[model samples]
Target: MNSDEELSPFNSFQFWRVPLPELDLSLLETEPSAGSYIAPSTKDLEAMET
Candidate 1:
């Protein structure tokens, strides 16, 4: 095997054997709370309009 292939995680069978953790995708489906939003300042809005 080439040096590149030896360095790659994909080349090892053990890499594929390890199972990934289950992710909670429900959080991604929900809308972010209004408090999380940062509204642009009036100066920034005026600059964008111009």
Candidate 2:
């Protein structure tokens, strides 16, 4: 997966898997990570090419 890509919400998950009988959508409202994404440059790629 690309670091710069924003992954879809539970790309491989289904809501039915949750065992809760009455889960609210508001409970899952949390901020995503603010970390900066760094894609390796050509120089770095070349160094590891061997």
Candidate 3:
């Protein structure tokens, strides 16, 4: 096979580009909340050791 045929197996190829709209952050919540942390189980700790 030639160099161009080896590079591309298809006879036709097309390239497309679509423009996206701008984003609005005014509707989103900006406040941060604290999350609760839980300790790992004894079974989980034993699996990590192996």
Off by over 4 Å in 2: 1-34
lDDT of 3 by residue, 1-50 (tens): 57886756454443233556888876474654356355789999999999
Which candidate, 1 or 3, would have the higher lDDT against the true structure? 1
Q: How many backbone clashes does candidate 2 have?
A: 0
Residue pair clashes in candidate 3: none
- Which stretches of model 1 miss by more than 4 angstroms? 1-16, 38-50
**Model 3: residues with Cα > 4 Å off, grouped in runs:** 1-34
**What are the Cα lDDT values of the candidates?**
0.81, 0.65, 0.64
Model 1 worst lDDT run, 10 consecutive residues: 29-38
Alpha-carbon TM-score of each model against the true structure: 0.33, 0.29, 0.31
- Ranked by TM-score, the better of candidates 1 and 3 is 1
TM-score of predicted structure 1: 0.33
- Tell me how far the alpha carbon of residue 19 in candidate 3 is from the true structure, in angstroms, after superposition: 66
Q: Per-candidate RMSD vs. true structure?
A: 8.0, 20.5, 11.2
Rank all candidate structures by their lDDT, best first, as comma-separated numbers: 1, 2, 3
Tens-place lDDT digits, model 2, residues 1-50: 54533544445467336675876877575754467456899999999997
Structural RMSD, model 3: 11.2
- In candidate 3, how many Å is residue 8 off? 99
